[model samples]
Target: MSFFSRRKLSEQELNNYQQQLNEFKYKITKFEDRLDKLQNDLECKSQGEPLQGVNVINAEEAANRVEKAAQKALPHELKEAFDEINSAVENEQQSVRLFQYELGAYVCANGKPQRKRIYHIDALSKKLKKYGYETKLDSNGPNSFLEVSWKGKETSDISKIDPAKKYVLPLEDTECEITDSATGKAISYEVAYACPRDDKWRIIYDRKICSDAVIVPGKEIIDVPKWVRSIEPIEVDY
Candidate 1:
Protein backbone atom coordinates (compact mmCIF):
# COMPACT_ATOMS: atom_id res chain seq x y z
CA MET A 1 0.00 0.00 0.00
CA SER A 2 1.07 3.60 -0.53
CA PHE A 3 2.54 5.56 2.44
CA PHE A 4 -0.40 8.07 2.38
CA SER A 5 -2.94 5.20 2.32
CA ARG A 6 -1.24 3.54 5.33
CA ARG A 7 -1.07 6.92 7.17
CA LYS A 8 -4.80 7.56 6.53
CA LEU A 9 -5.68 4.06 7.84
CA SER A 10 -3.60 4.69 11.03
CA GLU A 11 -5.42 7.97 11.67
CA GLN A 12 -8.80 6.21 11.31
CA GLU A 13 -7.70 3.49 13.72
CA LEU A 14 -6.53 6.08 16.25
CA ASN A 15 -9.87 7.92 16.04
CA ASN A 16 -11.76 4.63 16.58
CA TYR A 17 -9.61 3.88 19.66
CA GLN A 18 -10.27 7.38 21.08
CA GLN A 19 -14.03 6.97 20.50
CA GLN A 20 -14.01 3.67 22.36
CA LEU A 21 -12.02 5.21 25.21
CA ASN A 22 -14.53 8.08 25.48
CA GLU A 23 -17.43 5.57 25.58
CA PHE A 24 -15.71 3.69 28.39
CA LYS A 25 -15.18 6.88 30.38
CA TYR A 26 -18.81 7.89 29.90
CA LYS A 27 -19.96 4.47 31.10
CA ILE A 28 -17.73 4.71 34.18
CA THR A 29 -19.26 8.05 35.13
CA LYS A 30 -22.82 6.68 34.71
CA PHE A 31 -21.97 3.62 36.81
CA GLU A 32 -20.44 5.73 39.58
CA ASP A 33 -23.59 7.90 39.70
CA ARG A 34 -25.77 4.82 39.98
CA LEU A 35 -23.58 3.43 42.78
CA ASP A 36 -23.92 6.68 44.73
CA LYS A 37 -27.73 6.56 44.39
CA LEU A 38 -27.86 2.98 45.59
CA GLN A 39 -25.67 3.80 48.56
CA ASN A 40 -27.97 6.63 49.58
CA ASP A 41 -31.00 4.33 49.32
CA LEU A 42 -29.26 1.77 51.52
CA GLU A 43 -28.57 4.48 54.08
CA CYS A 44 -32.26 5.35 54.13
CA LYS A 45 -33.28 1.69 54.52
CA SER A 46 -30.99 1.05 57.49
CA GLN A 47 -31.50 4.41 59.15
CA GLY A 48 -32.15 3.23 62.70
CA GLU A 49 -30.09 1.75 65.54
CA PRO A 50 -31.12 -1.58 67.04
CA LEU A 51 -34.35 -1.50 69.02
CA GLN A 52 -36.96 -4.02 70.18
CA GLY A 53 -40.52 -4.52 68.75
CA VAL A 54 -41.14 -0.79 68.39
CA ASN A 55 -38.70 -0.36 65.53
CA VAL A 56 -38.76 -3.93 64.21
CA ILE A 57 -39.37 -4.89 60.57
CA ASN A 58 -42.12 -7.42 60.12
CA ALA A 59 -40.94 -10.51 58.28
CA GLU A 60 -44.50 -11.73 57.66
CA GLU A 61 -45.12 -8.65 55.59
CA ALA A 62 -42.17 -9.36 53.40
CA ALA A 63 -43.08 -13.00 52.91
CA ASN A 64 -46.69 -12.08 52.33
CA ARG A 65 -45.61 -9.58 49.73
CA VAL A 66 -43.75 -12.30 47.93
CA GLU A 67 -46.69 -14.67 48.31
CA LYS A 68 -49.17 -11.97 47.45
CA ALA A 69 -47.28 -11.01 44.35
CA ALA A 70 -47.37 -14.65 43.36
CA GLN A 71 -50.99 -15.00 44.39
CA LYS A 72 -52.22 -11.80 42.81
CA ALA A 73 -50.54 -12.91 39.62
CA LEU A 74 -52.48 -16.18 39.78
CA PRO A 75 -56.19 -17.06 39.39
CA HIS A 76 -58.93 -16.38 41.91
CA GLU A 77 -59.52 -19.97 43.02
CA LEU A 78 -55.81 -20.49 43.48
CA LYS A 79 -55.39 -17.34 45.54
CA GLU A 80 -58.40 -18.44 47.56
CA ALA A 81 -56.80 -21.74 48.45
CA PHE A 82 -53.55 -19.97 49.20
CA ASP A 83 -55.41 -17.58 51.51
CA GLU A 84 -57.09 -20.51 53.24
CA ILE A 85 -53.78 -22.14 54.02
CA ASN A 86 -52.24 -18.88 55.16
CA SER A 87 -55.28 -18.25 57.36
CA ALA A 88 -54.95 -21.64 59.04
CA VAL A 89 -51.51 -20.75 60.34
CA GLU A 90 -51.54 -20.04 64.08
CA ASN A 91 -50.30 -16.57 64.90
CA GLU A 92 -46.55 -16.57 65.58
CA GLN A 93 -46.56 -20.34 65.13
CA GLN A 94 -44.37 -21.23 62.14
CA SER A 95 -44.75 -24.93 61.49
CA VAL A 96 -48.02 -26.80 60.98
CA ARG A 97 -48.87 -30.47 60.46
CA LEU A 98 -51.62 -30.92 57.88
CA PHE A 99 -51.63 -34.57 56.80
CA GLN A 100 -50.05 -37.88 57.75
CA TYR A 101 -48.86 -40.54 55.41
CA GLU A 102 -50.51 -44.01 55.56
CA LEU A 103 -47.34 -44.89 57.50
CA GLY A 104 -46.36 -46.26 54.03
CA ALA A 105 -46.36 -49.95 54.83
CA TYR A 106 -43.54 -52.30 53.88
CA VAL A 107 -46.15 -55.10 53.32
CA CYS A 108 -43.97 -57.02 55.77
CA ALA A 109 -43.89 -57.10 59.58
CA ASN A 110 -40.09 -56.85 59.60
CA GLY A 111 -40.20 -53.05 59.30
CA LYS A 112 -42.30 -50.67 61.44
CA PRO A 113 -44.57 -49.74 58.49
CA GLN A 114 -41.91 -47.17 57.58
CA ARG A 115 -43.51 -44.30 59.43
CA LYS A 116 -42.92 -41.61 56.83
CA ARG A 117 -44.24 -38.26 58.00
CA ILE A 118 -45.58 -35.83 55.44
CA TYR A 119 -45.24 -32.14 56.34
CA HIS A 120 -46.90 -29.30 54.40
CA ILE A 121 -49.15 -26.15 54.29
CA ASP A 122 -49.11 -23.70 57.22
CA ALA A 123 -45.90 -25.40 58.25
CA LEU A 124 -44.48 -23.08 55.61
CA SER A 125 -45.41 -19.70 57.16
CA LYS A 126 -43.67 -20.27 60.48
CA LYS A 127 -40.62 -22.06 59.10
CA LEU A 128 -39.81 -19.20 56.71
CA LYS A 129 -40.04 -16.61 59.48
CA LYS A 130 -37.07 -17.89 61.47
CA TYR A 131 -34.37 -16.49 59.23
CA GLY A 132 -32.62 -13.13 59.53
CA TYR A 133 -34.79 -11.23 57.04
CA GLU A 134 -35.03 -7.77 55.62
CA THR A 135 -37.05 -6.29 52.73
CA LYS A 136 -37.11 -2.74 51.40
CA LEU A 137 -40.61 -1.84 52.55
CA ASP A 138 -42.04 0.28 55.33
CA SER A 139 -41.67 -1.25 58.82
CA ASN A 140 -45.35 -0.61 59.64
CA GLY A 141 -46.77 -2.11 56.46
CA PRO A 142 -47.87 -5.72 57.03
CA ASN A 143 -47.00 -8.67 59.30
CA SER A 144 -45.05 -11.80 58.25
CA PHE A 145 -43.82 -15.07 59.73
CA LEU A 146 -40.07 -15.30 60.36
CA GLU A 147 -38.07 -18.40 61.26
CA VAL A 148 -34.42 -19.02 62.03
CA SER A 149 -32.57 -21.78 60.21
CA TRP A 150 -32.07 -24.92 62.28
CA LYS A 151 -28.72 -25.54 60.61
CA GLY A 152 -27.11 -22.43 59.11
CA LYS A 153 -26.89 -18.84 60.37
CA GLU A 154 -27.50 -17.29 56.96
CA THR A 155 -31.09 -16.56 55.81
CA SER A 156 -31.41 -17.44 52.15
CA ASP A 157 -33.73 -20.42 51.67
CA ILE A 158 -35.17 -20.85 55.15
CA SER A 159 -38.11 -22.96 53.95
CA LYS A 160 -39.91 -24.21 50.91
CA ILE A 161 -43.61 -23.48 50.41
CA ASP A 162 -44.47 -27.12 49.96
CA PRO A 163 -47.34 -27.26 47.46
CA ALA A 164 -49.77 -30.15 47.71
CA LYS A 165 -49.78 -31.77 44.31
CA LYS A 166 -53.56 -31.80 44.32
CA TYR A 167 -55.77 -31.68 41.22
CA VAL A 168 -54.01 -34.75 39.86
CA LEU A 169 -56.22 -34.81 36.75
CA PRO A 170 -58.91 -35.42 39.34
CA LEU A 171 -59.20 -31.60 39.45
CA GLU A 172 -59.01 -30.10 35.95
CA ASP A 173 -56.14 -28.76 33.81
CA THR A 174 -52.45 -28.66 34.63
CA GLU A 175 -50.68 -26.41 32.18
CA CYS A 176 -51.84 -22.82 32.57
CA GLU A 177 -51.37 -19.13 31.79
CA ILE A 178 -51.63 -17.48 35.17
CA THR A 179 -51.13 -13.99 36.50
CA ASP A 180 -51.34 -12.32 39.88
CA SER A 181 -54.77 -10.71 39.51
CA ALA A 182 -53.74 -8.25 42.18
CA THR A 183 -50.18 -7.53 41.08
CA GLY A 184 -50.18 -8.67 37.43
CA LYS A 185 -47.00 -10.83 37.51
CA ALA A 186 -47.61 -13.45 34.83
CA ILE A 187 -46.76 -17.04 33.94
CA SER A 188 -47.67 -18.96 30.81
CA TYR A 189 -47.50 -22.74 30.69
CA GLU A 190 -48.13 -25.76 28.50
CA VAL A 191 -48.52 -28.28 31.29
CA ALA A 192 -51.59 -30.22 32.45
CA TYR A 193 -54.56 -28.39 33.89
CA ALA A 194 -56.72 -29.80 36.70
CA CYS A 195 -59.71 -27.86 37.97
CA PRO A 196 -63.50 -27.72 37.78
CA ARG A 197 -65.15 -25.75 34.99
CA ASP A 198 -68.50 -25.16 33.29
CA ASP A 199 -67.13 -25.80 29.83
CA LYS A 200 -65.55 -22.40 30.23
CA TRP A 201 -61.85 -21.66 30.49
CA ARG A 202 -60.83 -19.83 33.61
CA ILE A 203 -57.98 -17.43 33.14
CA ILE A 204 -55.47 -18.26 35.87
CA TYR A 205 -54.05 -15.15 37.50
CA ASP A 206 -52.19 -16.27 40.61
CA ARG A 207 -50.23 -19.05 42.34
CA LYS A 208 -51.88 -22.45 41.93
CA ILE A 209 -50.20 -25.82 41.59
CA CYS A 210 -51.67 -27.73 38.66
CA SER A 211 -50.66 -31.27 39.65
CA ASP A 212 -48.87 -33.54 37.20
CA ALA A 213 -48.28 -30.56 34.93
CA VAL A 214 -45.78 -31.30 32.18
CA ILE A 215 -42.96 -28.78 32.02
CA VAL A 216 -40.27 -29.32 29.39
CA PRO A 217 -37.01 -27.47 29.96
CA GLY A 218 -34.45 -26.51 27.25
CA LYS A 219 -36.84 -27.89 24.61
CA GLU A 220 -40.29 -27.21 23.20
CA ILE A 221 -43.32 -28.78 24.91
CA ILE A 222 -45.68 -26.93 22.56
CA ASP A 223 -45.56 -26.31 18.80
CA VAL A 224 -44.23 -22.76 19.13
CA PRO A 225 -41.11 -22.85 21.26
CA LYS A 226 -41.50 -20.88 24.50
CA TRP A 227 -38.24 -19.83 26.11
CA VAL A 228 -37.73 -18.10 29.50
CA ARG A 229 -40.52 -20.18 31.04
CA SER A 230 -38.68 -22.62 33.25
CA ILE A 231 -40.29 -26.01 33.64
CA GLU A 232 -42.19 -25.99 36.89
CA PRO A 233 -40.09 -27.98 39.32
CA ILE A 234 -41.80 -30.75 41.26
CA GLU A 235 -38.99 -30.85 43.76
CA VAL A 236 -35.95 -28.65 44.14
CA ASP A 237 -32.43 -30.00 44.53
CA TYR A 238 -30.51 -28.30 47.29
Candidate 2:
Protein backbone atom coordinates (compact mmCIF):
# COMPACT_ATOMS: atom_id res chain seq x y z
CA MET A 1 0.00 0.00 0.00
CA SER A 2 1.13 3.59 -0.80
CA PHE A 3 1.95 5.90 2.15
CA PHE A 4 -1.30 7.89 1.78
CA SER A 5 -3.52 5.11 0.49
CA ARG A 6 -5.41 2.61 2.68
CA ARG A 7 -4.90 -1.06 1.95
CA LYS A 8 -7.96 -3.17 1.29
CA LEU A 9 -8.65 -5.69 4.08
CA SER A 10 -8.61 -9.35 3.03
CA GLU A 11 -11.92 -11.25 3.19
CA GLN A 12 -10.58 -13.30 6.14
CA GLU A 13 -9.58 -10.16 8.07
CA LEU A 14 -12.96 -8.53 7.39
CA ASN A 15 -14.78 -11.63 8.60
CA ASN A 16 -12.69 -11.69 11.79
CA TYR A 17 -13.48 -8.00 12.56
CA GLN A 18 -17.16 -8.58 11.90
CA GLN A 19 -17.16 -11.55 14.28
CA GLN A 20 -15.48 -9.48 16.97
CA LEU A 21 -17.95 -6.64 16.48
CA ASN A 22 -20.86 -9.06 16.73
CA GLU A 23 -19.47 -10.44 20.00
CA PHE A 24 -19.13 -6.92 21.43
CA LYS A 25 -22.69 -6.07 20.39
CA TYR A 26 -24.01 -9.30 21.88
CA LYS A 27 -22.27 -8.60 25.22
CA ILE A 28 -23.62 -5.03 25.30
CA THR A 29 -27.16 -6.21 24.60
CA LYS A 30 -26.99 -8.83 27.35
CA PHE A 31 -25.68 -6.25 29.79
CA GLU A 32 -28.50 -3.84 28.89
CA ASP A 33 -31.03 -6.60 29.32
CA ARG A 34 -29.67 -7.40 32.77
CA LEU A 35 -29.87 -3.72 33.73
CA ASP A 36 -33.44 -3.52 32.53
CA LYS A 37 -34.42 -6.60 34.51
CA LEU A 38 -32.82 -5.22 37.65
CA GLN A 39 -34.62 -1.90 37.24
CA ASN A 40 -37.91 -3.62 36.58
CA ASP A 41 -37.47 -5.87 39.61
CA LEU A 42 -36.72 -2.84 41.79
CA GLU A 43 -39.83 -1.05 40.53
CA CYS A 44 -41.98 -4.09 41.12
CA LYS A 45 -40.63 -4.34 44.65
CA SER A 46 -41.45 -0.67 45.32
CA GLN A 47 -44.97 -1.29 44.08
CA GLY A 48 -45.30 -4.29 46.46
CA GLU A 49 -45.43 -6.80 43.64
CA PRO A 50 -43.92 -10.25 44.03
CA LEU A 51 -40.66 -10.51 42.11
CA GLN A 52 -40.65 -13.19 39.42
CA GLY A 53 -38.40 -16.15 40.28
CA VAL A 54 -37.53 -14.60 43.63
CA ASN A 55 -38.43 -16.04 46.99
CA VAL A 56 -40.22 -13.28 48.84
CA ILE A 57 -40.27 -13.29 52.62
CA ASN A 58 -42.69 -11.60 54.99
CA ALA A 59 -41.53 -8.75 57.24
CA GLU A 60 -41.58 -10.93 60.34
CA GLU A 61 -39.65 -13.70 58.62
CA ALA A 62 -37.08 -11.25 57.33
CA ALA A 63 -36.66 -9.76 60.76
CA ASN A 64 -36.21 -13.20 62.23
CA ARG A 65 -33.56 -14.05 59.65
CA VAL A 66 -31.66 -10.88 60.41
CA GLU A 67 -31.80 -11.59 64.11
CA LYS A 68 -30.51 -15.09 63.57
CA ALA A 69 -27.69 -13.81 61.39
CA ALA A 70 -26.71 -11.29 64.05
CA GLN A 71 -26.75 -13.95 66.72
CA LYS A 72 -24.52 -16.13 64.59
CA ALA A 73 -22.09 -13.25 64.15
CA LEU A 74 -21.76 -12.53 67.89
CA PRO A 75 -18.76 -13.87 69.79
CA HIS A 76 -19.41 -16.79 72.13
CA GLU A 77 -17.92 -15.19 75.24
CA LEU A 78 -19.72 -11.94 74.57
CA LYS A 79 -23.03 -13.77 74.20
CA GLU A 80 -22.46 -15.66 77.43
CA ALA A 81 -21.58 -12.45 79.22
CA PHE A 82 -24.73 -10.80 77.91
CA ASP A 83 -26.86 -13.70 79.14
CA GLU A 84 -25.27 -13.57 82.57
CA ILE A 85 -25.74 -9.84 82.78
CA ASN A 86 -29.36 -10.15 81.75
CA SER A 87 -30.03 -12.80 84.37
CA ALA A 88 -28.38 -10.74 87.08
CA VAL A 89 -30.36 -7.69 86.10
CA GLU A 90 -33.63 -9.63 85.99
CA ASN A 91 -33.12 -11.18 89.43
CA GLU A 92 -31.63 -8.01 90.93
CA GLN A 93 -28.79 -10.05 92.34
CA GLN A 94 -25.12 -9.34 92.92
CA SER A 95 -23.12 -10.52 89.89
CA VAL A 96 -20.07 -9.63 87.88
CA ARG A 97 -20.81 -8.39 84.39
CA LEU A 98 -18.43 -7.80 81.51
CA PHE A 99 -18.77 -4.52 79.66
CA GLN A 100 -16.96 -3.93 76.40
CA TYR A 101 -16.28 -0.22 76.20
CA GLU A 102 -14.73 1.64 73.30
CA LEU A 103 -11.22 1.65 74.72
CA GLY A 104 -11.23 -1.54 76.81
CA ALA A 105 -13.35 -4.07 78.62
CA TYR A 106 -14.61 -3.56 82.19
CA VAL A 107 -15.76 -6.28 84.56
CA CYS A 108 -17.97 -4.72 87.21
CA ALA A 109 -19.90 -6.26 90.06
CA ASN A 110 -23.49 -5.20 90.54
CA GLY A 111 -25.42 -5.31 93.81
CA LYS A 112 -25.10 -4.48 97.49
CA PRO A 113 -21.80 -3.58 99.06
CA GLN A 114 -19.51 -6.51 99.65
CA ARG A 115 -16.27 -5.61 101.37
CA LYS A 116 -14.67 -9.04 101.29
CA ARG A 117 -15.57 -10.72 97.95
CA ILE A 118 -13.50 -9.70 94.94
CA TYR A 119 -16.23 -10.68 92.44
CA HIS A 120 -14.33 -13.49 90.66
CA ILE A 121 -11.71 -11.08 89.36
CA ASP A 122 -9.02 -13.74 89.09
CA ALA A 123 -11.16 -16.16 87.08
CA LEU A 124 -12.37 -13.44 84.75
CA SER A 125 -8.80 -12.24 84.22
CA LYS A 126 -7.69 -15.74 83.28
CA LYS A 127 -10.59 -16.16 80.88
CA LEU A 128 -9.77 -12.86 79.17
CA LYS A 129 -6.07 -13.76 79.01
CA LYS A 130 -6.95 -16.95 77.12
CA TYR A 131 -8.33 -14.76 74.35
CA GLY A 132 -5.00 -12.89 74.05
CA TYR A 133 -6.14 -10.05 76.28
CA GLU A 134 -4.28 -8.45 79.21
CA THR A 135 -6.36 -8.02 82.32
CA LYS A 136 -5.71 -5.64 85.20
CA LEU A 137 -7.52 -6.34 88.46
CA ASP A 138 -8.31 -3.17 90.34
CA SER A 139 -9.45 -4.31 93.81
CA ASN A 140 -7.63 -1.78 95.97
CA GLY A 141 -10.11 0.94 95.01
CA PRO A 142 -13.51 1.40 96.60
CA ASN A 143 -15.17 -0.47 93.77
CA SER A 144 -13.30 -3.58 92.73
CA PHE A 145 -13.16 -4.00 88.94
CA LEU A 146 -11.12 -5.64 86.21
CA GLU A 147 -9.91 -3.96 83.03
CA VAL A 148 -9.35 -5.99 79.85
CA SER A 149 -7.32 -4.77 76.87
CA TRP A 150 -5.59 -6.22 73.82
CA LYS A 151 -2.54 -8.19 74.85
CA GLY A 152 -0.02 -7.51 72.05
CA LYS A 153 0.75 -5.20 69.17
CA GLU A 154 -0.89 -7.59 66.72
CA THR A 155 -4.23 -7.09 68.38
CA SER A 156 -4.35 -3.36 67.68
CA ASP A 157 -5.70 -3.56 64.13
CA ILE A 158 -9.42 -4.07 64.01
CA SER A 159 -9.33 -4.75 60.28
CA LYS A 160 -7.69 -8.04 61.08
CA ILE A 161 -10.97 -9.22 62.54
CA ASP A 162 -12.86 -11.41 60.11
CA PRO A 163 -16.50 -10.49 60.38
CA ALA A 164 -17.62 -13.76 58.83
CA LYS A 165 -15.66 -15.69 61.44
CA LYS A 166 -15.67 -13.39 64.45
CA TYR A 167 -17.42 -10.37 65.94
CA VAL A 168 -16.33 -7.66 68.34
CA LEU A 169 -18.60 -6.83 71.25
CA PRO A 170 -18.38 -3.08 71.61
CA LEU A 171 -20.49 -1.15 74.12
CA GLU A 172 -23.33 1.10 73.17
CA ASP A 173 -22.42 4.65 72.03
CA THR A 174 -19.03 3.51 70.79
CA GLU A 175 -18.04 4.99 67.43
CA CYS A 176 -15.67 3.67 64.80
CA GLU A 177 -14.81 4.03 61.15
CA ILE A 178 -15.21 1.01 58.94
CA THR A 179 -14.41 0.31 55.30
CA ASP A 180 -17.25 -0.78 53.07
CA SER A 181 -16.34 -4.01 51.36
CA ALA A 182 -18.59 -3.30 48.40
CA THR A 183 -17.78 0.37 47.71
CA GLY A 184 -14.30 0.51 49.23
CA LYS A 185 -15.33 3.69 51.06
CA ALA A 186 -14.92 4.60 54.70
CA ILE A 187 -18.06 4.71 56.80
CA SER A 188 -18.60 5.68 60.44
CA TYR A 189 -21.08 3.88 62.64
CA GLU A 190 -22.36 4.34 66.18
CA VAL A 191 -22.43 0.90 67.80
CA ALA A 192 -25.16 -0.28 70.16
CA TYR A 193 -24.59 -3.39 72.21
CA ALA A 194 -27.32 -5.98 72.65
CA CYS A 195 -28.62 -6.56 76.16
CA PRO A 196 -31.82 -7.64 77.83
CA ARG A 197 -33.32 -4.38 76.68
CA ASP A 198 -32.09 -4.78 73.12
CA ASP A 199 -32.18 -8.15 71.46
CA LYS A 200 -29.40 -7.52 68.97
CA TRP A 201 -26.37 -5.31 68.65
CA ARG A 202 -26.65 -2.77 65.89
CA ILE A 203 -24.36 -0.61 63.80
CA ILE A 204 -25.96 2.62 62.76
CA TYR A 205 -23.96 3.98 59.88
CA ASP A 206 -23.89 7.64 59.01
CA ARG A 207 -26.85 8.88 57.00
CA LYS A 208 -24.54 9.95 54.22
CA ILE A 209 -23.40 6.38 53.61
CA CYS A 210 -25.47 3.64 52.08
CA SER A 211 -27.01 1.56 54.85
CA ASP A 212 -26.77 -1.64 52.83
CA ALA A 213 -23.07 -1.47 52.36
CA VAL A 214 -21.06 -4.32 53.91
CA ILE A 215 -18.47 -2.85 56.25
CA VAL A 216 -15.52 -4.02 58.29
CA PRO A 217 -13.71 -2.17 61.05
CA GLY A 218 -10.88 0.10 59.95
CA LYS A 219 -7.25 -0.34 60.91
CA GLU A 220 -7.37 0.56 64.60
CA ILE A 221 -7.81 -1.00 67.98
CA ILE A 222 -11.51 -0.90 68.81
CA ASP A 223 -11.60 -2.95 72.02
CA VAL A 224 -9.25 -0.96 74.19
CA PRO A 225 -10.96 1.21 76.82
CA LYS A 226 -8.65 4.18 77.37
CA TRP A 227 -10.08 5.86 80.45
CA VAL A 228 -11.36 4.79 83.85
CA ARG A 229 -14.26 6.30 85.72
CA SER A 230 -16.01 5.70 89.01
CA ILE A 231 -17.99 2.47 88.97
CA GLU A 232 -21.66 3.04 89.36
CA PRO A 233 -24.73 0.80 89.52
CA ILE A 234 -25.10 -1.25 86.38
CA GLU A 235 -28.28 -0.17 84.65
CA VAL A 236 -29.64 -2.74 82.18
CA ASP A 237 -32.79 -0.81 81.49
CA TYR A 238 -32.86 0.96 78.12
Scored by lDDT, the top model is 2
Judged by whole-model lDDT over C-alpha atoms, candidate 2 comes out at 0.38
Supply candidate 1's per-residue lDDT for 47: 82
lDDT of 1 by residue, 127-225 (tens): 223212111211221122222211212221213223332112111222244333345455333233222234211222222433222112211211210
Candidate 2: tens digits of C-alpha lDDT, residues 10-86: 88756754555455335433443443345555667879887878655455655464444333323333334435544
Q: What Cα-based lDDT does every candidate model obtain?
A: 0.30, 0.38
Model 2, residue 198: C-alpha shift (Å): 79
> What stretches of model 2 exceed 4 Å from their correct place?
1-6, 52-238
Question: Candidate 2, which ten residues in sequence have the lowest lDDT sum?
Answer: 228-237
TM-score of each: 0.18, 0.21
